[model samples]
Target: MRISKEEIMDAAKKLEPRLIAFRRDLHENPELSLEETETAAKVAAFLRSIGLSPKLEVGGHGVIADVVGSTPGPTIALRADMDALPIMEETGLPFASNRPGIMHACGHDAHTAIVLGAASILVERKERLAGTVRLLFQGAEEINAGAKAMIRDGALDGVDEIYGLHNLPTLAVGMAATRKGPLMGSVDRIELTLEGRGAHGAIPDQGADPIVAAAAVISGLQTIVSREVSPFSPVVVTIGSIHAGQANNVIPHRAEMTGTVRAFDPAVRRQLPDRLRRIAVRIAEAHRCEAELRYIEQVPVLVSEDGCLAHAQRTIDWLLGAERHAEAAPTLAGEDFSVYLESVPGCFFWLGSGPSDRAEDAYGLHHPKFDIQEEALAVGSAALASIALLRGQSNHSLLL
Candidate 1:
């Protein structure tokens, strides 16, 4: 049941220019999370061109196109996110984003293009395959809604296993990286509201000011990770934004602050919000003010299946060899695709997309200037298609 890797590579190479154009087009006309109207339409058109009946608007711009093989076997799903970031492109390329305040800085455009290229090849080789293949184009990944929406819409109807990939700017091209577990961290949002009486700047004891209490609460949160959480595990609590007084002379009665908590294990992930609430309330009580704390779970940690990534990584090694590949370093950043891992055994890896010339200074994903090297498209497509077809000796259970 060996697939023609050479044929797959040839097809991918032939489709490289179109894939680049699609990526650039998606980059030029980037759409925000959950609002991928144009992007979805373009994907649908491309699928249709490749003779796939793409179901549109599934899970708010998420799309699925299935390819059924000649013989019944298993359902393996390949997913790609299509949503863009709110960043404005600054790459200065000819196909730079025409839309302001929106860009595919995350390399989702490359993900979509590679998935589309794989779709073209998979359709051609559909009859030779033994099972079903699903191409999942998800939207709203940046906002953490698309994956859930797709699941609610039954994106995993016949899926037995799923796989997805992302681009890594720091890694050099021709390399891919993955791991066995906890590849990404869980993400949750928390907010603190401090309430106090407005006070004049010159008054020493006129009223209780929440601004002072909030400042204490913010600083107090720092001790949670250093003193409370275990040093062995990585935990991050960051206050990204704060809003308080508008005037210089008077202290505002209400001060609001929002921050994020990230951890790999569920125990710590749950502990963070509770600890934040306790910390803020105690700090505010000391200042004669009251604090309200709220925690919202955003995305779960991305845990790669044990031995599952090894097979995919082997496929990558066959293509790129060992020299270019590097082991992926864990990050506190979160991905909603963790939701998919909840239901099935799978792994999400990163394809190195930066140019070798400026690998040290390559622009990172989610940055306005983030742009991938064009050659990475063919590399990604060939790797994805090959891995999807390469069922290793360890896949005995999956085969049966």
Candidate 2:
């Protein structure tokens, strides 16, 4: 039998205190990407405490647990990231990070807590459940490596479908949003080095000014989005850092630059590297300098399968009322969760954690002061649990 909204809500309420405590503990002891040893241990311990045996170190600190239901049905996987950023904590909450230079600025702690809470609820209703629910606590999401590692380790070996959510601080609390097709863009890192002869600053003709070439290259890259790409297609080329000369009186031998590229369309993403390289090389040649471009394609665009998204939206509507859900526009930010979606049909949604009263509580993700409204814990947990239960029951069809 499928779990009802009321039942999930009640379970969430009863589990809220424990959920908050678990989230706080994770928040206090944040770990970095690919190095979530302690965090992985804690997650495994929590799963065991709830009578589930989890496989540890699946992919360098990733933890996976399976909760088999009373009967056979489609297996669904739920995932949460366990890594923190390099930023220092500025949110003066009592449970602020004890580890300096690391903080849960992206709400991964809350994601982990919500998934654990869902696991607890599912375990309680195991006898009524129709299939298995797999919990994936992933590491290194910040660096976009964890999901791939987990998949390599066979996290999705028997998983029929997958689901995950990120906390959106801008969305009002008690709400959720998702949509079909591309929900998040692909990310590529670009590095360029312009080589030129060094000479005294006073002798303009003696040296090839790579700094000038670098400036032109940066300007030229901007035109790729505005002129080369379709205006309707979203793409971004941002030069985040540039390093040239050390002394004011001397020309530098080389100028180095690093930036990122984001695109939602696959065609646009595939052509970015060649276009950027062409732009850099031609611009550098114009200034009598040699250019080397390194473009590393990272994560792919996160697309939601049509059926999975419909199911997720229906589940959210049922859990929080139809009025509480919205169709989220595609975002440029990249998520490693896209890795898992590549292997399985799934939907990744956004859970609203923004506060209604305090503007400070709406601090965006990755900001030092970023935080989620604790009440979102219950909303996310209940929604996730409801989705799993509904999907697990073979006879249950979404009331869309």
Candidate 3:
């Protein structure tokens, strides 16, 4: 027996008010990455109330629960990140974060509520499901470590395929979007340090200024994208922070800089470390200084498997009219859900939560004033539940 689309949509609509309250509760008590104790407790309590036993503290505060069907089939996993950003709340909503300097600026509160909503709907139809549904309430997504932590804790031990969604504040509420391949970029960090002789600012040639070398290296790094990389390939190398001398009269012996690099193509991602290092070292050496560069690759590009993407599209169309589905444009933003895709074929997509149809008119994610339309809560829930049910009822072999 397969759960019908009408059932999922009807359930989501009826539970919209509770979903909003749950999301507001999470928003009021936001926790930072790896510090989600109370949030985890709430998740566990909710799961228990719904007649499911959730494994607490999996992956450093992650919550996991499995909904088993009467018949045997493939297992599908749904993920929702459960962490907040460091920004202070500015939305002034009655349910705003109580923790100072911590806010759910990334719609993670809504994501958690939406997944929990799906869990409730799935539990009601568990007897009709053809396979099992694993719910992953992940932590530390802001630090890009939650997915790995969940995996280490065996979140994906028996999972056949996975699906997850992130609420896009810019996208209009009630609309959903996704792409076939390379939907989002990979995340990599760059740290550079330059060392040179220090002397008085008045000296003619007494000091080898690391500040000068650092400037040259930063300029040289830009050419890696303009001159080396192809125009068609999307890559971003942003030097977000730099530190050097303190006084006007003294030349600093050491200068440090930090940056982030992003790319959608794996080959381009692989080439970044060497290229960035080469530019920094050669440029620093040219200015009579030595440079040390450290490039750390964090997450891979989020590539959606064709089969899984098609499944999501069908779900979105079935639940909300086919016109509601959109082919999302690729972005340089990185998501740790890519980590799950590396191990098992899956699709991570965008669910619209914007206030209006003009996505550009709304505040983007991570802003202090960032927020999602409450209506998106039910839309996200129905989409997630429908995705699982549709896949579960199908022939797993043919689908995946």
Candidate 4:
């Protein structure tokens, strides 16, 4: 039996106070990636308080638990990232981060709270559920390692499907968005070291000048996106960091550059590293320097399966009305949730948290002032609960 929309909404509404409290507590005491021991403890305690036994430290501080149904069926896993970023809180929202350099700038606090709220709602309707709801409070999402760690520890061992959400500051409160496939991009890192002879800045012939080679390599990297790949296939090659000489006059012996590459197509993603390596190495050599490149594949593109995406769409429409659902545009931002989707059929969606509904007016994720609308908490909780409750069921089961 599927739980009614009203029941889930009402339960989420009733739990708002506790949800806000839990979210605020998490916001005030944020922990960085792979260091969420206290956060996991609190989540586990909350699960235990609701009479569910959660497995602690599943993947270096990840917390996992299940809300079993009266009848045996497929297990639907709901995930929440628990780690914060390294930015200092500047929101001044009364419950700003207590940790000096750690902040919940990515809304993982909201995600964690929303999943906990869903757990509460699911527990109350446990007898009516046709399947189990697994709760995954993952750590280190900022580093993109949490999902892999949890999966390695068997987080998806018995789970047939999974679902999760990230709060979007641009999406307005009371609204939700997702797409059928390729919702987010894959993230890869590139590190290039250019080696050249060093000499006095005044004498150009005396030194190879790796700094000049670095400049040429940087400019050459952009051509791969514009000249090599198809304009229709989106790809981003960003050289975010560079280091070279200590003194202004003396030429540096070595120059190092680090960057990020994002793409949507798997074929495009696979070709980026080779293109980058060739461009950087050949360019540096042309400038009389030797180049060494390291390309690290961080996360794969996030594609939402049609089945799970349809369930999420129906759930959102039923709970918040058809007007609240949106066909979200694909983003180049990387999410570790994509890792879970790779292991099982699942959907990762956006929960509107924008105060004015205009995302541009608000700070984006990873910003020092990044935050979400508190009202989105209950909406997200209800959406997550409704999705799991209606899993493997027909569209006619929706109250709408």
TM-score versus the correct structure, for each prediction:
0.96, 0.97, 0.96, 0.97
| Per-residue C-alpha lDDT of model 3 across residues 1-400, encoded as one tens digit per residue | 4455677778999999998998999999999999999999999998999999999999999999999977787799999998999998899899989999999999999999999999998899887676899999999999999999999999999899999999998788889998988999999889999999998999928989999998888889889889999989989999999999899999989999999999989999899898898889988889889999999889999998988888887777777777877889999999999999999988989999997657778889899888889999998999998888778665432222
Clashing pairs in 4: 170-359
Give the Å error, residue 264, model 4.
0.9
Worst 10 residues of 2 by lDDT: 391-400
Go through the candidates in order and give the clash count of each: 0, 0, 0, 1
How much does each candidate deviate from the true structure in C-alpha RMSD? 2.3, 1.7, 2.2, 1.3
Instruction: Kindly indicate the candidate among 2 and 4 with the higher TM-score.
Output: 4
For model 4 the local lDDT of residue 59 reads 85
The parts of candidate 2 lying over 4 Å away from their true place are: 357-361, 394-400
lDDT of 2 by residue, 188-221 (tens): 8999999999999999799999998998999999
C-alpha lDDT score of every prediction, in listed order: 0.85, 0.91, 0.90, 0.91
Of 1 and 3, the candidate ahead on TM-score is 3
Ranking by lDDT: 2, 4, 3, 1
Q: Write the per-residue lDDT of candidate 4 for residues 216-243, one digit (tens) a residue.
A: 8889999988899999899999999999
Runs in model 1 deviating more than 4 A are: 392-400
